[model samples]
Target chain A: SQCPQKWKRIFCTRCNSKRHSRDRCPSVWRVYLLKDDRPKKRKKLILPMHSIYCYNCGLKGHFGDDCDLRRSSRVPNEDGSAFSGDNLTNSLKKEYFQ
Target chain B: SKDEDANILNMDFPWTINRDHSKQKEIADWLTLEIRDFVSYISPNRKEIELRNQTIGKLRDAVQHHWPDANLHVFGSYATDLYLPGSDIDCVVNSKAGDKQSRNCLYSLASHLKKEGLAEDIEIIAKARVPIIKFVEPLSKIHVDVSFERTNGLEAAKLIRGWLDSTNGLRELVLIVKQFLQARRLNKVHTGGLGGFSIICLVYSFLHLHPRILANEINPIENLGVLLIDFFELYGKNFGYDHVALSVMNGKATYLPKSNWKELHPIKSTFQLAIQDPGDATNNISRGSFNIRDIKKAFAGAFDLLTNRCFELHRAKLKDRQGCSILGNVIKYRGKARDFRDE
Candidate 1:
């Protein structure tokens, strides 16, 4: 008797990875706080590959929600065909999915 | 002079989205470092760990001296190494007697604990679903909860230990999430909040299914900040709670549609959070957590606050970024600090 092998299918449109869905992509931007403690010299960190740009303002540093600039026409239309930043934060991305 | 220079340097925020090409990675590194510091801050020290061991030993001696057939074992967060300061130690007794949860046995243990001067503020709850005794160890001042013949917790502790060994950031994430929920009073299952087991499952599943993690593209240690945000986003805003359920069975994390889970057929609420119990296939671990709405809302709020704070801090002048904390808004621990445990 042999065990059955199940193939799990996952795809992330955000980072275009076949290993995971859009919800888990690393292209999504996140910011954290800095501690006030010591440690004079900090070591450099290895970064992931991220090329995602903000959908609203077409910026690279931030996402749609954090985009301070006026909403641009680059937003996805009703047909879901235009520039799709699938990595947008949930509050902004949920309606896009619906 | 060096210290002053370092202080001044620290006051200036080094990474910004506009300035740094790998701003996301920088943020992840910062978050990972902060998570490590927070876990180290809240973890039990040598003195605390020694005290707990002594407490457990004294408890085992007292229980066995009174009932030669009974043996006590530690379980729950204390056993899983996921407990915060002032958290209660969960214990379970194994006895040959079938009626250990009976009122007579409960009162007997309470009496023995009282007589031995090992316990104070002893309260026996015989009418609850699982009859047990709760008390504060007089000398150590540590709260303890003991149940009779309930080995499920002990088993769960072993499972969590295995998870801790296998998962890279399980302990750090669990501790952070635990503190976050505790701060908001959303960690208690009795009050309809998520319990320790369910919380662990949620984090475990999130880590296993993360795109970068799945593809071996990111080191969990270097990318905890973005991972943490993704966790909140998945649960807070993206997860289809009304139609989907969570499962972490067999080390494979997945989201199962409600209709696909045959074990959850007995559960009536279609909108409830359903997490399949790894120990028992037929069980839903999160059935007791009825406050899914509040939990989801809190997670969403955390996502907003973290992203907003990041955006503001990034846009702020370097001088203005001084003394700001990103995790402080979500997790606030003002209690007595503990010495960092030697690895």
Candidate 2:
């Protein structure tokens, strides 16, 4: 028997259907198969070009490190166990490895 | 009897059933020994590790010639100390020297390596999420993938190593679980299976939470065996598809406030198993090239083999009972890919 892992539903942005994505919707796939044509969405080509966002929180208007909720400036817990065991501070301890 | 060799071969390799039902303890003991031996067999030996390191160093040297300031690292299994006997070397090159726009750096690096006779099939897959240069050493048959992805390689490696050192027997337990997953053919991510990082995270999440729930007086190693069984059981039977998020950070199920994780983070939420990366909370290690249903089914299959009546016959006298067969069924058997397409 095949192991069943649920597929992360790739949806059609416009129709919000699992059957097809905006690029290859049934409406498009059916036509493209017969006519040998590209999807309307691709043909139009209105893509988001220069959109930059926080790599960490994936938010707008700031960098990942500068983002407010990035745990950017983490301090040891008040209990004082050396490192929070989080070890975010020493993220680039490349020298130690070298 | 005169033509014994041919007769034996013709008789479909004669086998004897010395299964003494009364000697269940002895059978369990034998299984345990087999498992212990399997662990050693699957592990990256000193020579293997050294060879891998040397291979990585050769690649780094090649890359450095082109870009003197480039920092090439051996990441993934080699860095994390969880490689099997013949695991591929995963390398990441962090360089300020190349066209950072696309994987242009990788393509350029690939061309440079090609000049040095770095073996055949040197391909640059620049369109991948982490665009990589994949090549195989023709002589040693060692495969290496070099990525120019902006990854915190050192931090990621250190975090895992630190976690391994945190608890006794943790490293061994992780290795054993990895072996189990590999044997079952469910360890591959590209073929809609769980990768090594995600598997390690899953086991960590299990061991972390088990201590709180199951209060046993057994030593850590024995405790690991029990936890391993539960690892299959919990993910197989109890885990909810929409409800719980698998995480190793807090050592517990990090519950999503609402039912759907995809709805909450639609942009990046891709996998049925959202294993939260401890180092970077935003990064879901389980995402990319995985089918949720398949992973769940693999767990369910393992659980069934472990708990079902017939399979349990051989397991009854074993210390962890499901120990021997759990690893066997997952590692040895190959199952068809169940319904996993999004639609």
Candidate 3:
């Protein structure tokens, strides 16, 4: 017989959900800035940043330090700015710093 | 037996690190597979685990024989299932009577172990903060440490079990980190090295506080390779050791600045690797680990090695990539090796 699954009565302080834990909570984004159990509400409606592309690995989910793929020799777009380091960092700060 | 022999032979030929991958996702995918394979390769197999269980059983019987009320309880890495090969088994003798820690009790148990032939090389350390009997099981040659009347190790083991159960990819990352530290002889606690518990907190905090993980953007299992590098980079080069402390209290893992920790623990060292003990907030779990400089430098070196190897492999010709291992640059598995991807 299969062993019974371990029961854990956990409360997610981030989103105040019992169905999920804090780390897996959908409402928990950038937990480093969390000051208390009641996470501050974002001023702007935050969309999933998975679409943000990384020039290093040519992936859409991450960029900068988050991108561990080997650095590409050239950017995909030379003339048109697909994304800029300053813009990415600024947007990230604005979204996560609230 | 034939397959085992073939695997032993495979160890002689070094494993390959990477193949041609254009996207970061592809490399991440490759790394995830390698991490899985490496963990399985180094992990104790069924026979080895069974031997540990039998060893524990023998010690338990011996303890109960002497004191019918006393019982031996396995704790630490053995109990948590996070142990690497050759790691000593940690146990505590629980009894209603509080005299199990006396000098006489320690020597009596040591003598009993010697007479029974179940143990050898017995050493009774009575002057320790916690009196313990250290011995090696004659049959398995496995080292074991038995302490008297302690429940803290058991509690810590249970906490780790809860973590391993809830967190995805925690075991994989922990095993890799443990092996990495073990290779450099930096895993010993008495010598001011990062112990198993401290390493767990480090990886646990990194996983929980990672921007990508917290945002639910990347699956950790799919991105173990990248996460491994980022782990090194954060702890090695970026983490503010003097200002930042790690915590896993109330099932929430996060990095707390030292100033905030100072409010709770005013007298604690400000520039040390302070991981607040989960059981008691006032106590620092990583207080014994004093070699922060060496640990940080080693982690930074690993980050450099992994990134440099990844870059070199990315630019290498297909023929040059043969038998090159990126993870090998950091952790060398001194075990019978076999390629799992080929199977």
Candidate 4:
């Protein structure tokens, strides 16, 4: 066979770059095509978000009483706006829904 | 000769000359002149209208001649103003020497007054009250209380003044609380109602609220002193001064008027209890009077509630059997119930 003069560089299928071979590439370039696939191992991440308690609903793991969905559900809605009833009825409904 | 002349010049003639017993006008004139001359050195503003001060000055001068290092201080109601028209004048005479020397100094001073004819009708009670000599001068019928303690031991005097000052707030609160209770007839606790305990309850409640209202809102030291004075004053006004004196003397629980008592819950107790006795009987003592125990209990209760601590109960005999403890069985029961519910 005749000797070849030059070889073509391999492109990364993940990052779409020609910088290095697949094994030498950064982990950030790795992508999982499906949820079942193992996620790439990288440095530990610390997010800025934090959880707060909702006063109105008397529940943990939420921010702001006004933003509590549970409180919205407790509000009266006689005009069929969303939810409405006496305290007993609402409590019963909450029990049923919960 | 000039020094002798100066000494003679300084010797006031009115005080030097003695008047006959039959010459009342002359004695009175001479005494008045002597007082005017003595007061001449003092500023007009500093001059007290009290003849007691004049007598004290004369005594002070006489004592100075014997014990030049002696220092005099004034104390008691006269220093503050728990004084009535007949309040006794209290003075303390302190010396660098010990008690024996101080006593000798006092004796010599008393004798000097006698030689000057100032002590003829004056009753010099050497062994009268502790910490004070009871001297009743015939010149003014004013009882002068004198003491011979070291000047260094002024802590008691300072504490008295401090306590009096601290009570001003307590006094104002007492007046307001008394008026409130009286107006609402919440005081009808004694006799056939809640009895003296109701006043205790009201005072405790007031004290409980005091720290909260006073914290950061007022000066604690100053306010506390004022409150205390006010509290004592109110207590004196409502309760007879005799009751307080007896309580202090005998260490007994004093009583207050039903009109000045404040039931914890007026509406709840109104139906279950009688407001007043039909016989219109009055308490021998007033509602505002308090003993050391009462003060301790009040402070302890107030502090406990403020700090969220359990209150300690001190028991006393009541009507034969040891009465209900001061921490009240009802209050304890309610507190336990609350705790149980919380748990």
Cα lDDT of all candidates, in order? 0.68, 0.51, 0.69, 0.33
Q: Is candidate 1 or candidate 4 better by TM-score?
A: 1
TM-score of each: 0.74, 0.60, 0.75, 0.31
Best by TM-score: 3
List the candidate 4 regions with Cα displacement exceeding 4 Å: A1-98, B1-53, B99-106, B117-132, B138-140, B151-153, B160-343
For candidate 2, the lDDT comes to 0.51
Candidate with maximal DockQ: 1
Comparison by TM-score, 1 against 2, better one: 1
Q: Model 4 Cα displacement at B242 (Å)?
A: 22
Given the true complex, what DockQ would model 4 score? 0.01
> For residues B230-249, could you state the per-residue lDDT of candidate 2 as single tens digits?
46655554443343455545
- Candidate RMSDs in Å, in order, are 13.3, 21.0, 14.5, 33.5
Winner by lDDT:
3
Model 3 alpha-carbon miss at residue B195, Å: 0.8
Per-residue lDDT tens digits for candidate 3, residues B1-343, read 3355554554522333233232333444546667776776656777787888998898899999989889999999999889887889999998988678889898888888889998899888888888898999999999999999999999999999998888877899999999899888889989999999999988887776566565444567766887787688667765556655677787786556555675465744344688888899888888888898889889889976876676566656667765556687788766544333332
- Order of candidate numbers by lDDT, starting with the best: 3, 1, 2, 4
Give one digit per residue, the lDDT tens place, for model 4 in B170-284: 3233322333233333334333222232343334323322322212223322233233322332232221222111111111112222223333222221112112211122222
State the local distance difference test value for candidate 1. 0.68
Q: List residue ranges in candidate 2 displaced over 4 A.
A: A1-98, B1-33, B97-104, B183-185, B212-216, B250-271, B308-326, B333-343
